[model samples]
Target: MSLSRTAMLLALVLSGAQAGQTVVAIRGEDFLINGKPTLEGRTWRKHDVEGLLPNSRMVQGIFDDLNPETARQWAYPDTGTWDAERNTREFVAAMKAWREHGLLAFTLNLQGGSPQGYSKNQPWHNSAFDESGVLREAYLVRLKAILDEADRLGMAVILGYFYFGQDEHLKDEAAVIHATDAATDWIVKRGYRHVLVEINNECDVRYDHAILKPERVHELIDRVKRRSAEAGVPLLASTSYGGGSLPGPKVVKAADFLLLHGNGVKGPEAIRSMVERTRKMEGYRGQPIVFNEDDHFDFEMENNHFTAATAAGASWGYFDFRMKDEGFAEGFQSVPVDWSISSERKKGFFRLLAEMSGEGK
Candidate 1:
């Protein structure tokens, strides 16, 4: 019980609880991984360190306005060569840094950001995903290249297809409407099997971010699944919405797994409440639990929450952007990060969970 956060997180990564382990059905009470009655706390990281928001609504809410300030803060400036090679290289390096902590990287592609002419807005309009000006082939080739690197590294990439329209352009949930067949074709055509597409970002229910009506989101998945089936691939659609339980507004059957976005919830309070609430829901009683995105230093909560969730029968997904002294990885620089652990140490909290599961014994 006496261990640092870094040590604990690594334990989770090395816990021998992989994605495709055994038949421990996503439902029921207390699951087991790889035939062993071990807890499944899947520690991982995301590649948003360079300013792209993968699965968090904070970035979407901030960037939805198309404000220059948030743009610059996210590092999606109009600078850098207006091509995918440079873009891919930048992300590849970042992803490599994350894997060093024994975590998986999730990539994002915002529709707003692009290089010079590629972007519609002048100056800062350019973003990491401004493909309007870049050669279509160049963009596809480079994108696939980044995905290949991710696939090679055994990491997951949450292809950011769109963001909330908080900025001037204001695409938000409505952007999906403009997502033409060509774009959908591109998502399915030019990528490896590892590619997973998230149709929407942190879409709020209280405030409509042009959200794809739940039925539409559901339809989108069906369409994508059909296309993915033709290519022998499984397509994934996700959203970062508020959490209450399977009974809440976010309880839609569009995605393959259960996902939730977290704020800076104090300790395991929100997590515990979220789980209990989920258990009370009809379909989510024993579903796969994914903390798709959240703020850092929640290591204590992560450590404690993951244990609580699996015991109640579920799986957890951890994410980070940078490996800075891993109590939890930091995505944006402005968010002060604690260097209590090494930049590359991710086993701080989960490390204990791993020991409990008898991993590395």
Candidate 2:
């Protein structure tokens, strides 16, 4: 095929592939889907619920272990075999439940999070980008399935490109950059309007390359924004920080929305405090402050992280990981996840989400 003809055909194919179902955008401190504010005009206990995005960290939705040694570890209890397709299939099937419970968003990483939750070392190779930074088709196929479903349901996806533990899988700085460019191109060409690009999971964590670190990670955020802008897709981009840490001045300025984590934060009051302190930072210009990952949950209480964040005009996300004795139905980040709202903890979070989002109405 002629080069120009090939390019034209590619554009047509890409345009027809997904059909651009949902559109997510930021307007000052609010999130808008399809030109209207999220949860428009709603209030939860005197807090303005309009424009806030309630989310959860479900990073392993497209998870797969390439290392033979570790691949066997995620085997289902019933099947006694690990199946990446089944993992994503189950994840897709569970999305409606989450959406019905008033979840407007969820985080899914290209390089999946540590199946062990918090680990000093990650031996499993679970990245969607190869060492040379090329996109893996198998992973993208699964991700497309999830993103397509989220689009149909009007849910926004905080699509993350790299996780700290998995970023080391890329060979060097160039590979990281290549991976970012490639991922950005793919998302843009796919015509997904519901996707928010998170350049990396936590910029403050230990990363193999300096560019992916906190000081310079904003460069990648800007890169994604630039590339997407050139393509006319214009994805909203940001990188997150470690638990309870405030975003730096550089990212606060570059990012379209500020992403926060509440894992290391101690209490509900601390959660409220983090949101308060973030607004006072140098480059903060009233962008939507969203906690896309927080392991805390006290849904039955009078006040908790969720309550506190909403009260402070910030959005909150639930990060559930199965404890040592917990079963399949426990954690959303753990491998071989039971994506259903099965356990008490999962129920508590969704129950509160439903009540607040007025899904229970």
Candidate 3:
């Protein structure tokens, strides 16, 4: 076996994680997998890559639309049909390649993000929770399979519980709270140590529920932490803000780590400034700052969102969506995704990732 593989196995054993499971922990501003810093001892271009969790946004990995009317929209070209099982199978098959390309983590949402990448109005019913905030068994089964695979590969999952576009699925605030507690309970029961809880994607975005909004979102975050701690699993939890905005005092104080987005932010300098401003925000603590959903990418450039975030001591994530006139091979967020490392855009991101994470060497 390779030395890295041996070390990973040893780490898993030492950390008391079950066989074929990944354990994620936070140490100050560093992210640790099985008690060891991610990208251990690695640096790129005078930037400290060690301890950073390089990730991407793959929110729709196990996506399925419960609404049959809209389900047909995500049909694969080859099969001319939409199969959630096939989508998940292909997603799992591509994960090892993603890991090989130096991706340590990715974001997944139960209520998936916009299938159109950035939709103004979401008419599709795509939620894992029912109107009562109970998780559907079908979705849980698929989620378990994905989480199991992520564990076996030694990768961390930033598992998001809600998304703005799909929040209407839950009936009310009570249901939202129930979903949060239920999700947390499910994760604990499943014995997943490598999962971080993202309460909602972009809490400041349009949401039907007030509990999911920025001011009160921390209540859910604190609830997740409390519920998980009571269960003895103690999962790390947080919520993210919209692009270029600083996290409010509540989230800043309550979150285990800060999650940011670069979707609407412009330029590398702006990215750096966002990170800087976050660090100085009220109730700011020295937790790891992560940009888990950034749509900007200029991988070949000396400075970009990825580079700028890293230089400012924040981990960055790639959020690629199907742009106008792009084919299936282009975007990870677009429906009917080609999960392989196909297309120039995909190759560019992974190529730079490999170089930065020392995977190429």
TM-score of each: 0.57, 0.95, 0.94
**Which segments of candidate 1 are over 4 A away from where they belong?**
1-87, 105-107, 112-142, 166-175, 178-180, 205-216, 230-232, 243-251, 282-286, 298-361
> Which tens-of-lDDT digit does each residue in 1-361 have in candidate 1?
1224323422322223222212212123322222333224433331112111122111210122134453343343345212223334444454454444433335355442221111233334422233322223334444544555566655555565544331223344333434523445665564444445555544443224334444345555566666666765446555545433232334444555555644454445666666566556554534444565544444444355444443444334443344334322333211122212234324443353233333331
Regarding lDDT, does 1 or 3 come out ahead?
3
lDDT of each: 0.40, 0.90, 0.88
Ten-residue stretch with the least lDDT total in model 1: 47-56
- Over 128-194, each residue of candidate 2 has an lDDT whose tens digit, in order, gives 9999999987777677778888988899999999988888899999999999999999999978899
The reply for model 3, stretches above 4 Å from the true place, is 1-20
User: Relative to the unseen true structure, what is the Cα RMSD of model 1?
Assistant: 11.8
- Show the lowest summed lDDT stretch of 10 residues, model 3: 8-17
- On TM-score, the candidate that comes out on top is 2
Better of 2 and 3 by TM-score: 2
Candidate 2 residues lying further than 4 Å off, grouped into runs, are 1-18
What C-alpha root-mean-square deviation, in Å, does candidate 2 show against the real structure?
4.8
Question: Residue 15's C-alpha lDDT in candidate 1?
Answer: 27
For TM-score, candidate 1 versus 2, the one ahead is 2
Better of 2 and 3 by lDDT: 2
